[model samples]
Each structure stands twice: as structure tokens, then as C-alpha cells.
Target: MKRPDCPSSSHLSSTTPNAGRTWEEIVADKQRTDAAKIPPEWVLPPAVVAGAEARRSLVGAFIEGLLDAETCRITDMDVPDLVGLMESGAFTAVQVTTAFCRRAAVVHQLTRNMLEIGFNNALKRAAELDDYFRAHNKLIGPLHGIPFTLKDQFHIKGLETCMAFVGWIGTFEGNKGTGKEREFESEIIKEFHRLGAIPIGKASCSPETSNNILGYLWSPHNQQLSSGGSSGGEAVMQALKGSAFGVGTDIGGSVSMPASFNGVFSLKPSSGRISMKDVANTGPGQQIMPTVAGIMGRSVTTLRLVLKSLLSTEPWLQDPYVVPLPWRELEDCCPGKGLAKSKPTFGFMENDGIVIPHPPVQRALGLVKRALQEAGYETIDWGPPSNLESLQIHGHIARGDGCPDVWRALQLSGEPEVPQISGLFEPDGPRDPMSLPEYQDVVVHMRDYRNRYQEYWMSTAGLTKTGRPVDVFISPVTATAGLLPEKFFHAEYTNSTNVLDFPTVVIPVTFVDKDIDVGDPNFKPITETDAINMAAYDASAYHGAPAAVQVVGRRLSEEKVLAMAELVVEALSLCKAKGHGPSSVG
Candidate 1:
């Protein structure tokens, strides 16, 4: 079975009339149609586009400078705050939607992040929301009037689901006569509609966030670095405040890694905690390691709210794959929950003993550790089941079928495999799939690995001063702060959590400081991959990139994980107040 996303095609290059045109024609039509959606006034001038191209950073002042003061102020506010303003009638849904749509337009032009533009439709829906609010004299729901974007993998009623494949451009997941085009809506979209959130656009989705479609998406924080990917475009959008929040699919750190790289907050929950129903996915019958939809936003608060809102819809009732777990406020886990009890203990894993993160990431972990300690929380060095164990289980269980579907999807339009995923295919086609017995063996290994990991987590209670297992463990989101294109060399930090099926949240800690984040000169390599990862690190090249950490919790622990993330954010803010915070460094 192919991935749920259905691989993309190049072009039919129709040999007969009415067959199809060239890949170039498809790409041009796609771009032209998407561009037509943006209001004329939102179109960017050539000079400004040139200026954006010349800069290393397009975030903060750079991107905002292009927008009007109101749009900047509106877009800068996080989701919860924006919804609050709407509830108070200080801002209408149209106002919020228009602000984000305009800013998203500017961002798409500058970064090529948007794969499907829906500004006109978004504004129309926003008006309906405003009318409902006016008639009801009350807010519609928790997420009322918020604007959001999603990876192009989700089928929205008024937009295309390109998934960044040129051949898949005008069709519904590469099927020409499916009749579902623009008619079928993903389950999540239904939930979002009920909550009153308007989707402004769908973003680019590629193996490394690139394809023949919208081009490569660069990190808004540091133009020289990768936006992290398959969800890279969504991460870049959130980093640039293109939307109030974003939804991305993650099979193996797809959402978390990009969020970390783009300097945005993200939540990659245990598979069933969030609905994957109706979302275009990566693999089929691949439940041993299923792809999950994750939320990315400017802050943990935004991530928390979005997840909670989705849960409030009780998506499980409609999507069979969703775990029937309602949003657990887990009030007892929130700050000030001590009430004479011990504060939450935390686990810190600076390295997996396989690959050492670069200096920027090391500093980020150090900052988190110190902040947690200073805030009166107990911290312990964490050593769980070796990530190498997970490294073994992930790929086989994920693509044991050899991803023949991906090849066929690309072949539909005669599109060749992309460089990032080129190695995934053979010279002629996808590699032969592992036999069922072999695949089953890998599944058994994954089961045992997960069991061992859980046991190890529980055993940590014996090591913590609090006499309780650590509430969450902090680890690097990736070994690199910002990727220098293909120089990225490790995914153990993020992928291990996926294999374990644990819920994880990523928080941006600080900017990569070429000076302050100087790495150890006498470091010894633990393994060949480690050596290559370290050797790939160039402090100057990674500078200006965001350094981040992931807070990981046990399976189905999304609420607790989110609460812990807030704690980290608070602790870091406290550290900054003392003038020695990671934020103070760069």
C-alpha cells in the first residue's frame, strides 16, 4: 500500500488530445491558480521580493516590515489571545482572518510556503463566523474566529491537496476523475469548522519540504537553513506567523523536527490521541508505526489550545482511529498544583550516547536544565532504552512494503523521485518489500522495545529525589540547530520518540549564537554517524538559526506534556529576567 498522501506525479505529457499536458504546464497552472487567490493589493512588489531574497532572516522585523502595523500586531498575537479578543468583540473573525490572510500572502510570496491559497474563501468563512457571533451575542466556540493553515495533505472543501507533487497538482491525490476534488473534506476540517477556525491555506509538503511544485521552503529565521520537512512549509508558516496555528503530519519527526528548526512550538501526540481520519497520509496498513497529525504554533499555549479544542470536539466519536480520550485538563499537573505535594520532577537527556548535538543544541539543553533546577524542580540524567533500538524498528515497520505506492504516484505523471527521497527508490522502481515474516519480526521487535522503554521510564522513580518517575524528559529535537541543506546527519532524538509512540512537544529555546555556542574542540566521536554529524557542524553557518528542545511524555500523555512545556517556558522566562537566560545570549 502507498502512503495515505498518495505519491505525487510529474506529468502525463499526453501523447493524445485531452490526455494531459507536460509537468511544466501542470506546475505553471498550479502556481497561476494559487496566485490568483491572493487579493491584488496583497501581491508583493519585485523590489521587496528581491530584498527578502538577499536577507538571511525574514522573520521578526523583516517579514513584519512588509505588513501594515495592524496586521503585524494582529498576527503577532498567539491563538488563545486572538480568540480572546474575538470573544470580547474587540476583533471580528473577518478582521483576524483578513490580517492573517494578508500576512500569509506576503509570507507565501517570500518563502513559497503555501501550496494552496484560500484567502478569498477564508475571508468568506470568517464573515459567516462574525455574523454568527453578532446574532448569538456570544462566541461560537473555544476556537471561534481563529485563522489556521495545514499541510497540503488535508483535503479542505475549497482548496487543493497537492502534497507538493507537480503531477498531483490539479487532481485529487493524483486521481483525475475521483469526483472528490474540493468536495471531500477531512474529518479534522469538520471539527475545525465546528470550532469556528478558518483555514487560510494549505502549505507545501515534501520529503525535505521541496518538490517541483512550490520550490524549497527556507526557514524564516535563517534563510541559509532548511525549514525541516515534510512539514517544513507549515513550520515556516508558523515561524513567519503566516497563520495563527498549523497542522502537519508526522510519521518520523516530520512535524517535531521542522517545528524545532523553524523555531515554533509543536505537539506530536501518540497516534490515536489525534484523528488521522480523512487526512492524506504516508503509508497504508502501516499501523505498526502510523503517521499522526501534529499542531504547530507560535507558543506552547497555542499548541495546547488547538489540541484541547480538537479533543473537545470528541473527534474519537467520529474518527475510529482517535483514542476516546477527552482533553485531560490535568489540572493537578499545572503550575501551583503542589498544594503541599512535591513539584514535578524532570528527566534531562542531553545526548542519546549515539550522536552528540551541536553546541547550540547543547546550550539549549543546558539552559533548560538550569532553569528547571532554579525553579525548584528536581532533575535527573535520563538513560532510557537505547535509541539505536528504535532506529532499528522505525523504517522497517514504517515502509516494510518498500513504498511501491510512492513510486507509482510519481510515475503517474512521469515525475522522477526527488533528491531527498531518491535513495528510497531503486534505479527502476521501489525496492522489493520485506517478506511478511520478516516484517512481523520487526513488529515484535518494536513491541519489545516499547515495553522495555516504558519499564525503564518507570524505573527512574528510584533515581529521582522526588521519589516519582520524572514527569517529562527534555531532549534535543535534532542534533543540528539549523540544517545546512543535506548536511543534517541525525534524527534519533526525534525519531526515537515516534517509535516509542510517545507524545512530545518542542519549544524554541534560543537563537544559535556562533560565539557563545562554541563546541568542544577535543570532543571524541562515539560512532561514525556521530563523527559525521559533528563534522557537519559549522558554528557560523548555523548562527541566527533557532536552537530548540523537545519535552517528551509517555503515550497518551498530551495534557501532561503540554503542562510541562508551559513550565519550561516559565522557567526560561525567569532565567531571562535574571539576565543569564539562553534568550539573553543571542
Candidate 2:
């Protein structure tokens, strides 16, 4: 079991040799000379392959010949097809689960996306489902035997929820003697378990999915680019089909931004739709704008399936914070109903008009507008109030408590904060907690902003051909497709939705293209921040990054948001076929 390249205990007699080597020296030596020290099953090739070795470590060799022909064939199958196979006995749960696990193993070796490996546990559960079906002649549930991964933040029964903090490696949230370490489960975990979805493992995450545990999470679509953080790991996993679906948490744009950045779909509901109970948080005390669990997946239908099944468990009964309302089947919101009966009006806001979207993002928006118009959907220019209001409101409420809770958690181990979260604190400690009056003032401002936004939304009724309020307003998810480190300037696209408490569905509409996405010649700066954000735009660096739009709905109206998202997708498809301007996923 001794690796050739790695030093064995037998070789380190008395540990008197090379003990003074620096950490960087040790790591560099391992990377360059200790090839055998690398785990064979985890090395991923840079390219996609129709077949590859299931048990090899060489990235290129593995992907070039990674799986049994049958497994490789089934691995590329989508969710609905996989479900059909399960229902018809075309494949057993073991077969499907094994294929995905192997594929996931490869993905991890290549991307280092997973934090834990629960393939054995997942296969065991899959076998149990097979037994249940044999005994009762029924599917376990809608997501029967489906393999999925979660953001490391979710605690599973037998796995650790490290959330990428090294301090939390052995103890429960960095504490020992806690009985709940592996015994406890997140609310979402419970629901997924009941739905017969097995967790193959947990994915890596940075503050933007750029944490220390797994290093940088790169987009499978383009390894040279970032996967998008917070949920970057989950997004990459889904992009590579390492899981049937994946879960992530979004406070600002954690979930949506990654999904957009990695060319996947995600739903970031308003606070109460999904449960966050029993989940670890950095600053749990700041409950004003709480982080909610969101789903990321290959398709919108899969995301819907996960959400609908979670709702079936009636999570509200167990978690008091969960909304009591069940998932209302909105036949009224269906395209054939509200959307088809009228040329639904869409309020189009290209940019917040604060920080302008980069060329690729702008091109993506233009595509969406033309698609909607071609599909007989009315498009109106959306000129809303200053996004600067939410910019002010976000930081105050999101981190105003001085992040004492976050500080305490970090102190669990004497670990340095990751590069991504370094800006959250000063050299001394977390910033001072805002006073109660100032905090209350921010909250008041948030409330006023919401009412004014709603008023503006309603005012669109006068301008629309349908003479009704805009069905859904479309806007960029972020000012750019993928962010380069701390280049982000405007969070208004996402923060404004949070301030308004509106349901927002992020739809990946395009990729950053170096050739087509050029700088705007007539672009004018709206403010200092706007200028800085624009200046950070690099067409080449951003190439292949996914750009997406958010479909904003009224508070807690998830059904409507999803429905409109589908319609938008359909319209975009048609427009693309007809050779119109940029269509969805440009």
C-alpha cells in the first residue's frame, strides 16, 4: 500500500532528513516528482470521451478508455430517459448508480469537485430500492435511485459537512464530543432520502466556490475559466453529469451565479420555499436575508422535479421556518394558459443601468429580447429606479452584525480565511456590528425599495399591449458571465431580488465569445463603481463563461417564475432556428 513517490514511514527513520523543508517545497516536490503519490482513480483527462477507463488515474488515458461500453452508453443518458429505464427494468438501480459513480470518480479526478465520496452508501441505497420494487412492484418515489451530490454545507447521516473549512475536518463544525457529527442530517437531505435520491458525495465550494479544501472549482465547459462560486462545485458536477442533479445554497448569487457561469440551470427561490434548517452557516445570526437551499441541474425539469419532491415531504411541518404552503400546481401559470392566451408582456431591463453588462452578456440579452418578440411576446423597455438603493441595503443587512457568528466559527481552528472571503474582515477581526438604529434604517430602506419596485412592476400594465402587468421582468444575473477573482462591482442584479424578496430563476442563455462579444464603443459610465466594473471586462479571459438572465416573480411565486423560464427557453429555441439575433444560450 506504500506509494512509490510518497515517503513511507519505513523510509523516515527518526525523521531526521529533510524536516526543514517548507510547505511550498513539499507540495512542489509532490506535484512534479511524486507521481505515484497521486490517487489513480481521481485523475481526469482534459477532454470529454465516449469511452474511458473506470479504474485508471491518468486523466487522458482514463477519459480515452474509462468505462465498460454499456456503462459509458448509459452514463450520457438524461434524467427522464434514466427514469424510464428504471421503470421498465431496462437497467437496475445498481447499474445506473455504478455508472454515475464511476463517471463521478473521473470527474473528481479531473475537476476535484467532490468533498466526500459516498458511492458505496449510494449503491447500497440503490440496492434497497431494487428490493423495494421487487417486493411491492412500485417505484420508490419520483427520483427513485437517482444519484445526486450536494454542496458540502449539507450534513448527511454518515458524511461530514465541512463546508470547505479545514478546521471542521474531524469534529462536528470544528468541535469534538458532539454526538451529532455523522448522525445528524440537513432538512434537504431528509427529503432527498425519502424521494429515493442517493447522495454520491458532497461538492466543493468557495466563498464563490473557491475554498482551500478542494482548490479552485473550474467549469467543465471551459477548464481555463472559473466554474463560478459559492456553488461552483455543484455546477461543475451537474455540467459533467456526475450526478442526476446537484444542490447549492444562494444568499446573493451563490447558486445562480455558478449555474450561470457553468452553463447549467438553477432556481433560487425567495427565502422560505426551501428549508435551511439543520444546515451549517457562516453567520446564522443574520437571519434577515437568510441563505436558502437551491437546486442546480442539467435541465429545468430536473430542478423542478427536485423542488416538487422536496415539497411533497411537507418540510414545513418539521422546520418551522419552512413555508406552510405546499407546492401549488399552477395550471393558471402554464404557457398554454396565461402565456398562450395572451402575448405575455416582458419587462426588459438590459442592465441595472448602473454597471453595464459585458458584451457577451449584452449579446445574450439582445438574443432573449428578439426571441420573445419573434414568439409573439410583447417586450417593453424596463427603466426601473436606481439599483444603488439595493447596493446600499445588501451589505448593511447581509453583514451588518459584524459577522460575529462567522468569526466564532473561524476561530474553531486557527485557520486563515480563504482568499475569497479575506475581504469580509479587517486584519484584526470582523467589522464592528452595526447599531440597532442603523440596522433598522437599512431594513426600512429595503422595505421601501420593495414597494417602489412592485409599483414599478405594476406600472408596466399601462405600457404593455396585453394591458396587464408584465408577466415577468428579465434582467442579467450579474453584470458579467464569469467573474475573474474580485472583479465584481455590482451585485444589484441579485441583491435587488433579495431586497424585494422575489423569486428568481437563473436561466443560462449564452457563453462569453471573444470574437463576437466586443467592448461597447459608446458605453458611458453611470458611476464610479460602474466604471470600475466595465474596466474589469476582458473579452478573452471571459470566453466560454456562461451568461444567464433572471426571471423575477412576485414574492414566493416560484411556480410563475419557472413557467415563464420555460416559455423563454422555448422562444429562444425557435428564434435560434430561424436565424434571428442571439437566442438563449448564445
Candidate 3:
């Protein structure tokens, strides 16, 4: 009081504006200046840091002791097993849903993987299924109370699809005046609801699962590495068994890369296979290489169930963009049946001959090759049109128009551009838009690339043991086991599929082992990027990263992709039996 009686020079000095700041403004300025500093790459996002603080506030002291054997057991069941339990009346939907919800809550506390929690609604829906089962004495559908999560881009009724945009927090697509706030629903989400699937929550997502709101999504298997982006949150959820299955979208390798990095199975079907209506998109105007919905889970069976169930709903009717094609119970294309032989020939591309796969991936390719050889399948070395061609077409059509839409969406919330997307812009703002003429050239290139790719694929007939075109081709999903943040140098593996509009199934075949997966120094690099990529390899750093291969089939040939993926999985299982290397658990 005595100091204040002198009109406190300290308070006066604080009030004295440097330019125009008031006393409170000066305090806020300092706080914001401190807050604006970016975190180290290795550190989790501030939001994740805050989640840990929140959990501590709520749980007090017992959170550490709570992770015991029984808790883990309940969390390990896959979608099919959970559905089997519910169908047999061994467990009601309510019981299964409650277990997963509790486990998911714990996972979110540890990993900050969830962006929205629909626990109350999910439990209520589960109870309804239990009652329906009691009355009908039959399961509702194949999924029947299966718990799952989706990337925040999917619109779920009663939940806001903020999709990590601060501007999208309070409204539909960041528009406050739009009356459709929580009322809109995505077409694929509608299919899930109709299939008796329960939505546990929404997952965090970003360029690589890093954003201002949700921060970084860490791989639950190994926290030191990234979860893989755009779909990283979905992959992490599946890795931790936070959900029985998860859904994410891919334009480039978003789904496959994340699924591979997290040691899970995923299917990135061609566009129109799964409807994307009402889903939030990055570049809505650019439809050349449109993003497609994909499924990630612990097993191929889970993926099959989701795909079959959705197709049964006739998604094409509600979504005009969806193809009217129904899921075909593919006639056995096995050699003795559809073909003249018992085993079909397959084209194999160990690497694109551009970027060489790392040691773990090379080992995985060898395992698959040996397995197929032992099983009596013809494996022809696949040499096709350069994927470098797809690289050029992918950038122009995918990121052309300077990504003005992505920039505008980011601006709505005043959220800073994530470091992953920082390069998309100039120091000032997004780079100049691609001119109309230039953009057209890219489209033409993409079309030509597809034509040449198909021609090359058909050319496999001459190389096959059976005079038929190779059933499917196998290749690495990425050159590296898991990417170091921003270290991804090649997309030829995945982008080639997009360019060809081919269907692909990603099967995790092995994991990185520092002991056996050391790169050979004598190995010659095919191109400069290949040499640079090899130089970036460190055995210890990549240890435990999942190694996967892509089973690629012709456009609309999902059946063949799934079947061939099953064959690859079986072949690898046989190889593991011979005591050759690491095994694929999924």
C-alpha cells in the first residue's frame, strides 16, 4: 500500500506503452512471445504435453500401477475375435464396447491419439445392439458392435469434424453461420453406422500427425519415432489396440505409409471403391489424383469384413461419385480353376531401380520371394516404365494450383502451418499457383503414364509360366522401413499406384533388426537420390520399424489384390517356418 501510495513507478512503467501496448498487453506479449517458440523435433506437441498434465490432474497417483496384465489382455483382441465373442453371446456388445472405451481412454492419456471421444454415445449404441440381439437371437451385422476410430476428417453426427483446424473448431468446415454444425455425416461413416460398427472416438491427424491442436502422434510400439502422417493417428490407434479397426484416407502414401510404420495391415483401394462423400478434403478442386478412403487394422480378415459390409450397403446410391460396382466374391482365379495351372505367375519388383529399399525392406522382399518360390509360383523380375514418370505427374496434378485451398483452410483458424507442410509455401505465403496450361500438361502426363503402365503390366503375359498376365506384382511400400521426420525422399513406390489408379494391399512382412539388417557398403546406388537415401540409413535408428510390401493389382482388381496379399502372407509364414528371419505376426 505504501508503494502504491507513491503511484507505484513499477505499475506506471508497465503501463507506459512501447508503441501502443498497455500493462496487461505487455504481460500478454511476453507470454505469447514465449509460447510462439517451436518445440524440438524429438519432443511431443505441447497439446500432448498438456494431455499428460490433464491426466495427472485427474488420476492423481495410480495411473502408473493401472497398466497390468488383465488390462492388456482385454486390449489385444482384434475386430474378428471381438465380433466372434459378441455373436456367440460370450460377451455382449455393451461389455466389449466398455472394455475398449476404457482401454482407449488409457491409450489417449498415454499417447494423446484421440481428438474426440464419443464414449457415452458409443456405449449407448452398444447397449441398443445388445437389446436387439436379445430380441432377434442373431447378430446385427458382420461388424456388430466392433469399436473403431476414424481420422478427424470424417464427419460423424453429433461430433464436430474440426480436423485440427482451429477455425473449424466451432462450425462446419470453419463456417460459423452454416446451420449444419454437428448434423452432417460422411458417406462412409453412414455405412459404418449401418453395419453395426461403434465409433469409439476420432483420432488426431496432421501432415505427419503433427498439428497445432493435436500435436505429434507417436508410434505406441516405439515412442522415439513418428507415427506416419496424415493418417498417423489412425495407425497409432490400431497399433495400441485402441480400436478394433481404423479408417484413414490417402492421396500419396498416407494410409500405407502410416500402416507400414505402425506394423499393421491396410488396404488403399482405388477411388470410388469406398465413397468419400461429405468428407473434409484438402484440395477439393483438384480431382486428378483424388484421395481414397482406406482401412487399417490388425488383420486382413478385419479389413475384409469392413470392405464387404460397406459394399453390401450400396454406397453408390447415396454418393454419386461412388462406382455402382458391387463387391464380387471373386471366382477362384487359382491355376486349376480360372487359369490352366494351380499356381499363377507374379511380377516382382524388388525396388523401383530408382530408390533402393533399406536393409530391412530388402530382407522382407527376399523373404517373400523365397516363400513364393518354394510354393511353386512363378516370380518374374518386373521391369516397368520408370516410376520417376509418376513422380513428375503426381506433383503437378496433386499440388498444382499452388495448394491455394490448403492455404486458405489453414488461414481460417489462424493456426500456424505445420512444419511438415512448411515447404509448400514461400517465406511469405503459398507459392504462385500453377497456370492452367501447365496444369493441363500434368493431367496429360498422368493419363499417358497410366497407359504405359497398363501396357507394361499386360506385357507380363510373355514372361509368365502360364501364358496369362501376371496375377499381381509385389514391391516395397516405401524405400525405408519408417521415415525420419521430413526424410522421405521417394514416393515412386506408392505414387506409381496412384498414377496407374491401381488397387493395393499393404502387408507387414517383418520388422527391422539391427543384427541382421545392416546395409552393405559395396552395394551400388542406381541414382543420386538412391545414394543419398542409402547414406541416411542407420541400423540402430530403424530397428523395430515395420517392413512391408505392396501387392498391386490392375485397376478395380481389389479381389486379386486381397487374394494375392493372402498368398504373400502365407508364403512369409512358410519362410518364417524355415527359420530364415523375423516373422509377420499380422
Q: Which number leads on lDDT?
A: 1
Q: What TM-score does each of the candidates earn?
A: 0.95, 0.88, 0.87
User: 1-586, model 2: which lDDT tens digit per residue?
Assistant: 1111211122211212133543234334423432332346544444442222221122223443655677667777767778888988888888899888887877776666777778778889999999998898888888888898988899998777778765566568867779988788988888888888889888888665665455666566545456777888898887777788888888788888888877788888888889999898777877888888888887666777788888999999989998897887766556644345445678888978678888888888888888888888888988877888988888888889777666665555444466567667877788888889999988888888888988988998899876899888999988888766655677789888877778888888877778888788788898788889888888877766678888888888888788888788878777778876453452
What are the runs in model 3 whose C-alpha is more than 4 Å off? Answer: 1-71, 331-341
Encode model 1's per-residue lDDT on 290-320: one tens digit a residue: 8999999888878888898899999989998
Residue 140 error, candidate 1, Å: 1.3
Instruction: lDDT for model 2, please.
Output: 0.75
2 or 3, greater by lDDT: 3
Where is model 2 poorest over a 10-residue stretch in terms of lDDT? 1-10
lDDT of every model, 2 decimals: 0.84, 0.75, 0.77
Off by over 4 Å in 2: 1-69, 336-339, 581-586
Clashes of each: 7, 19, 3
Stronger candidate by TM-score (2 vs 3): 2
